[model samples]
Target: MKKNLLMWDETLFRDPEVLEIDYLPEQFEFRDSQIREMAFQIRPGLRGGRPLNTVCKGLPGTGKTTSIKKVFQEIEETTKKLVPVYINCQIDNTKFAIISQIYRKLVGHLPPSSGTSFKQVFDAVARILIKEEIVLLVALDDANYLLYENEINKVLYTLLRSHETYEGTRIGVIVIISDMDVDLSRAVDARVASVFRPTEIYFPPYADAEVREIMKARVMQGLFTGVLSESLLDLVVGQTLKSGDLRVGIDLLKRATLSAERAARRSIEREDICGAYEISKYLHLNYTVKTLKDEERQILRFLAERSINDHEMNAGDVYKAVRESVSIGYTRFYEIVKKMDAMRLVNLQYREGKGRTRIITLRYDPIKVLEYLS
Candidate 1:
């Protein structure tokens, strides 16, 4: 009898392109047109002109940040005539911190955070720009956040008006928000709103065909030849479109590849893709839960329980339900629902004549929440 041995080659099946969720570029794909347009719009400012103030809106993972970075790279390669800066609003919320970030970018020195009003910082930024004779294009990702927090007006007021006070220098702001639904002109005072009227651009969700093309390319680059079949590709694209999430698709591809590798299989089969989908929900749930506070988690649990028990529960009904069952006050409960809506965990809709009530539906199944709570 001859001895039998199993052999598998893992190197040929590894994924070299799967990015950690937080790393911006490793998972970035497509959006070449948007990058070119942004670079074109900002290029003129380098030769003693005002850069176009642009507002870019898109859902998460739609290549907003990635495209901007790509444009910035081109900008750096082509010319030193303009300065590019990026700030994530969620991480740095206050006016002072934002101004300090811009200051450090322009002046190459970290100024102390005390004894200087926003006016002083603006002056410093203007002086540096004028001295270098460079135009400035600043991108504030998550701009909607500042609008709600009341800090937007102050920051925009300074950036927009710096030209008036500084003389001969140009500063343009590229405001990036999650969606275009926010009518900023109506929100800001007319005087400030007119100055920051940016050229608006919208990024639609990727079509299923586009998703398939992207996934196929990634699979080819990240996995070995003949590793994934059409069946796995179809399933991944369908689930991704149904959920309206690119992260879901990327995650599924990564997991499926890993599953095949772990099983010492040469190729990823349909079963591997199915297994990936089965485990994806838990990863998403943990991500969502990590961002929530204790009260917020309690409120979500309340909504999930009510939603499972009763088919339809409005925001008011859910608020009352949480209040009645838990010791937290009504005010806190209302705030919790609003926060959940912002997180995209719960659906909130306005009924026109009626108040805007939150439709209590979990983005995932209620079983996910139960699993989380347990």
Candidate 2:
């Protein structure tokens, strides 16, 4: 039997998808300066020369990815001389995987995965770009992962130093990072740094008015004319400023609209906004959780389960509980916990005194985590 859902009789949203984080609104706001800088650096490619290598730095939801994507869209429309490609490092992280993504972007389909080696794919991409007489610009979003795994220099060697093997080909690179102040000299050797000659462009946190302007555009596009109230807008903007992440406000608006719809309300009330704001607290993850080891995922799963009956857990006891399900030593268990804490996935704090040891706190909504993990 089909279960009945208490959906609202009145529609509160016009086009709900406009509130999504990934949606590209008709009007882009408060990023004109950053966009101009990116365009200036990449303009050289239009003249059949390699563009300057760039390092784009910003906190999460500070418009790093969105600006890159927007500028690339404009570049594609103006000229065919430059081919723009974007790769998320967390997802296509390996040397071969990264190369394969560039290849797919150019070749229109991925090369045969089973029979191709790194050298073959590299040569194939180089030949295609050179034969077409086009310079390729690659944007590596969340590039710090490549540095952490000791893979940045190796990948750069394949791209920057490829002229040694494949004559007459030139490539441009863009690295997007969350920590604007990372030491590139330490992360990569002198050769890679010299070849890259990266020019850093920073994106600052959005101001309250800027955040409101952004929300206003999305609301006009997404919500009904009379459904959203000034009070709800004020609440969303306050939460956004407090969190310092525009995505939090966007997420809260989406969830709050859904809450109102579910309760059969024509207009979103303060209670619906409150319910959504609660879940938006921990929604900012600058990078995806794709890098978690199998063992770490097991630990997350275990803790997520434990959170059902317990709000917090003693770090030592949680390790004991995790060992029953996953085959990891006590030492490695603590190591993984420390690692996740550093990555900001969960809050693992060390304790003091004779009896206290450590405490573990989940930095995400439990209901969402279970839905995502399970």
Candidate 3:
């Protein structure tokens, strides 16, 4: 039994790195236009000219961030005249943290954890760029998170108009926005907005043919041939389309492969794929719920409970019910619902008729949510 437990198959993957989400493929399929557009906007920085501020707007998992990374990788390989700075706004959504990240990319050291101020870091970053005679092209991925945190305008104002404060210092900004609900320009200062008059590029959802091609490419690079059958691959691709995100398909495939491996299978079969899909959904829901605040979780539980009986309750109704368990104001409740909507835990739709209430439609398994917290 011990020997059997240790036994496994290495027949699938030639290299472990190929399957990692962080792995950048040598060949990027189905994003030629985005890659080219990003390159064009960023190319000016290499020539000692201002980079055209760029905005890559797309839904989550639409290759927006990866395409930017691919171009930045190429830029780094070919030139030292420009430095590429990538900061995920979700983790470093504050003004200070974002500036510190830029400073780290430039100086090869992190800013002091607490003592320094934003102005000090900004001044140091500016002075270094000026002394080195190089441009910094910064990509703030998932930048819309800044908006939710009310830091979007500050980040944009700080980056786009940064050069204005320092004579002869050049910094190009690329904003990667995943939230399509908000009109960001109206939220920022006009002067700051003027500097961010960017070349806008959009990445739409991939078609089924496109998804299949992507899966096939990943299969070649990640798994051994025949480890995943065409039919099972189609199953993943078809289900992934419902979300219109290729990363979900890639994730589903990787998780499916791991599920198969656990069963000591030589190849991934239909049952393995089915098991992977269900497990992935559960894990995804679990991880998201794990990140919520105690109060947020409390509200989520109430909504799930509310939805079980009514199956799409009014947003106001969920809040009123939740208040009995936790003393939260209506405004706070509305904010929590919006937060849940952004998290994709529930879908919020406004009704124009019959009462004109905001409808809350949960996106996860309500029964599992109860079990999840239990």
For all candidates, the clash counts are 0, 1, 0
Off by over 4 Å in 1: 1-9, 12-15, 18-33, 107-124, 164-169, 279-336, 349-362, 366-374
Ranking by TM-score: 3, 2, 1
Model 3 regions more than 4 Å off = 1-6, 9-11, 281-298, 320-329, 352-355, 367-374
TM-score of each: 0.77, 0.84, 0.88
Tens-digit per-residue lDDT, 70-115, candidate 1: 7776677788877788888866656787878889987788687678
Model 2 per-residue lDDT tens digits across residues 1-374 = 22433343547789978988888766788889998999999989888888888988888789999999998888899988799999988777789999999999898998898988998998889989889998989999888767655588888878887777888787889999875546665778888877888898989999878888888888889998867888789888898888888888999999998987887666778898788987776575423455765777788878777877787789889987778878889888887776666556678777887776798988776666666565
Candidate number that wins on TM-score, 1 or 2: 2
- 1 or 3, greater by lDDT: 3
Pick the lDDT winner.
2
Full-model lDDT, candidate 1: 0.73
C-alpha lDDT score of every prediction, in listed order: 0.73, 0.81, 0.80
lDDT of 3: 0.80
lDDT of residue 289 for candidate 2: 53
Extract clashing residue pairs from model 3: none
